[model samples]
Target chain A: MRTIFYISDGTALTAEAFGRAMLSMFPLKVVHKTLAFIDTEAKATAAVNKINQAYADSGERPVIFHTFVSIDIKRIIMSSQGSCYDFLDYFVTPLSKELGIPAQPKTHRTHGIQEDTGVRENYDFRIDAVNYSLANDDGSNVANYDEADIILLGVSRTGKTPTSLYLALHYGIKAANYPLTEDDNMENLQLPKVLKPHRHKIFGLTLDPQRLHEIRSKRREGSTYASLPQCRFELQEVEKMYRREAIPFLDSTRFSVEEIAAKILAETNIERHRF
Target chain B: MRTIFYISDGTALTAEAFGRAMLSMFPLKVVHKTLAFIDTEAKATAAVNKINQAYADSGERPVIFHTFVSIDIKRIIMSSQGSCYDFLDYFVTPLSKELGIPAQPKTHRTHGIQEDTGVRENYDFRIDAVNYSLANDDGSNVANYDEADIILLGVSRTGKTPTSLYLALHYGIKAANYPLTEDDNMENLQLPKVLKPHRHKIFGLTLDPQRLHEIRSKRREGSTYASLPQCRFELQEVEKMYRREAIPFLDSTRFSVEEIAAKILAETNIERHRF
Candidate 1:
């Protein structure tokens, strides 16, 4: 298999994003390597050697997606035996002309901490949101629902926890998730009383019964909790409650956590703390 | 302030990443707005209206970084009164030529579920890792240390939890973190007995004493636990223990969680389950 390299003088996160987005356009299987924080000339030379080695070993030119602030290091990387793509360098000129300002390329500017600024403030908000989500996970702290930006309601194993964490980590939104379990009376499910006052903040997640069955079976096989009938019945009740309570929800069977979080943000009016 | 828009037919995550990386090159303040899941022509027209409205309201052309698989939608977005940048379109021809494959542009491919493939497996790994990290957090499940790809050790408020979660969420690496607290004999700290066998998987995180003090102060006001002297002493003991035990450590004072996670991945040999 061919190798794809994401190299940068900083975290190389932008390079990874660039490569991943580009590669998503082609249905191809390839090995991935990231050379991050390649700041010095020596390190850049070493990176070039690795790229050349990959090329020799695979008998194909490796695809390199790189972003570097230092011209000298970037020049060294461009000289490597690979098909290099620098999205930053390609767009910087046009963007500079459009903004009518010279681009001030700096290392770590993309994913670095800038103290006493919005970046630092955003960092604190994300960490706090993570802690809040953990503290309120699975209805552990219902009293704090008033403080939540959004509360996720769903049956167990319908992907509440991961979605909650993704919202908190990526957007710095305080998301608390509560699972609808057997104690909620699956025969006649209702929004828990503690959640009634904060109904406006509720967003629900539901999975297809078959998908739920497979997921639950992995955890508790040969049990009624993992039974298809149980999964279908619980989903029917919870979705009915969603409509009855007028809670906006998504079918998470076809979406990743990133997509689910993005959809929730787009569907709701929750203000994201970070861009 | 000028408004920067990240518009996409899918999650808009790639557009946001592209725009943010480009914008980070300039020292300017701008408002960010994302219009995600604009798949239909009507939604495309609505997004154009939003973009045009931002241009008119600000008296400055909105900078739109967008990626759309549909040609009609792309054209509609381009027709809006904004400066548009489509990184995917710009890089596609070259990348396709390099790979010798026709670009199969698909919506939601970048951050969507691909059933029964590496993508789906990756998603499962991430969710499982998140559950594992939460379960093993703060040394809560010491018995599960053998399953951890990496274990982060740090004092209180040194950015262990966020880093652990980021490692799990972004890389699908099972990360468990243990907090080295006053219970560990702060005056003469040593690697806890539980962590001795898993020493090879250990990574230490330390922060500048002042930063730690400020972080703790936010949570506990002026308590002794939040004092500068106390913070300094704990960090000192932890760092001493890390070096004494021959564990790799990082001072996470100047980095964001993303950067810290990237640095840890670079410094360690932990195999990531996802690219």
Candidate 2:
């Protein structure tokens, strides 16, 4: 029954995310509204009125979350008859003092098109990594094995492709994944020719057979490939390969793509190229 | 010469991003530190001392950015000698008032494993879209054109792949991209047979010839394909094809992947499935 207002001078993605994170802790059904691009005084005033109206209607104060860079607009928002939390107002003065420089507040500059030429190189790096991941996906373009930062080896439907893409997209890491086939499993789980030279850069993904069975069943219903015994066999063989090759492996059953990416980066000691 | 500290009870990504955005406004070279997993009073005390030490050493107050769910830890951080800004303290009371519920401060629950089953469906949607983008990248598997939410058409290296991946990764939109080849251009700007049926869902991307040349040359140097004339001819023909086919096009010469993705979503009226 509560209204949560997110106000921002920019994209308000961070405000939205932080607000959701904090609000989810309480067991309540809440109405969330986001007012982005609130750079003008008139817009700020409009927001204040909307918030006050909500408070009056519900007989409860609306919680206003804002990340505004303009002191003037922030003052107008702070004057609203709601529970006002301004991100910049609480920190800018102290930051100015600590840095020995005055704050130059710019509207919509946080997540907007960057005029900072310094971030271009990093942006290009990430784009290149993303392209590399696509090109080398599923071991299709193994000719460029030498350029990969890490090679993920797993059986079918073990989250190799998504993990690789997440790593590339988020960390700018050149990740390639090779699917371990049934032939490899039957042939004593030896490393493929293309992957042998990149042994040091290889990581494996493992999961419980039951979970794998559930995932594969959804993709290929009533098929032998998706059967429980087939999943169990594949997982056992992959674990054997990982142990035999001394490749670090992770069980991706309970982990999200974010967690999987963090683990891969941390385990491999790969330095993330931040933008 | 100042120190910037990002303290959080969770992953600290928001705290870090907010700190960076705010710090970039001030022209100062600041040393950045992230103290994550600050869920305990002991951790908060240690962070306070660390902030004090940095302040004492530099003779400048450190700027501490925090998103603490716990009031006790927030109090400890606010008591530090540095300039402390706690995201929760300024808003939690009002949010409680607005929601008609008490704030249950939990640490590390924001970005950790989700206990919410409702989000699980959306997560699967995103993963499926990512797989679709990878499978359909660069016209590799265009057989599923009927299933796509949107199909992007562009020449090679016109940023088709990255944009498609971004759309899929962020919004769970089943985006498939087809590269406009020379054959399609030489055939009197005709649409490819594979793309003719799904013309309504197609979007075109165009960029400067020089930028295209620069990107292609890096991939395949010293070739007619990467020559200026080739890039110019291809770009000119693609624009002609876009006009002939009546495909909505975007000039992606200077936009970042993030900007391009947003533009694509907005122009196509494609609903973004937020996480």
The prediction achieving the highest DockQ against the true structure is: 1
Give a tens-digit lDDT track for model 2, residues A1-275: 55788887665655666676667667765667767667799988998999999988888678777787777888898899877665566667866775666787753355543546355666778889998997888889888989999999999999999989888877689999899887675447777877888899899999989988988999999899999998998888889878987999999887667667766764667767762
Q: Once model 2 is optimally superposed onto the true structure by TM-score, how far is the C-alpha of residue A193 displaced, in angstroms? A: 6.2
Per-residue lDDT tens digits for candidate 1, residues A68-181, read: 989999999999999999999899999999988889886337888787457988888999999999899999999898899999999999999988988999999999999999
TM-score of 2: 0.81
Interface RMSD of 1: 1.4
Error of 1 at A229 (Å): 0.7
Model 2: chain A TM-score against the true structure:
0.86
lDDT tens per residue, model 2, B1-275: 67888887665666766676676577665777777668799988998999999988998788887887677878898899988766656666766665667877753355444546345566778888998887888898878988898999988889998889888987789899999887675546678888989999999999999988988999999788899888888888888989987899998887777667766764576766653
List the global CA lDDT of all models.
Answer: 0.92, 0.78
Provide the clash count, candidate 2: 0
Model 1 alpha-carbon miss at residue B9, Å: 0.3
Task: Output the number of the lDDT-best candidate.
Answer: 1
List runs of model 1 lying over 4 Å from the truth: none
TM-score versus the correct structure, for each prediction? 0.99, 0.81
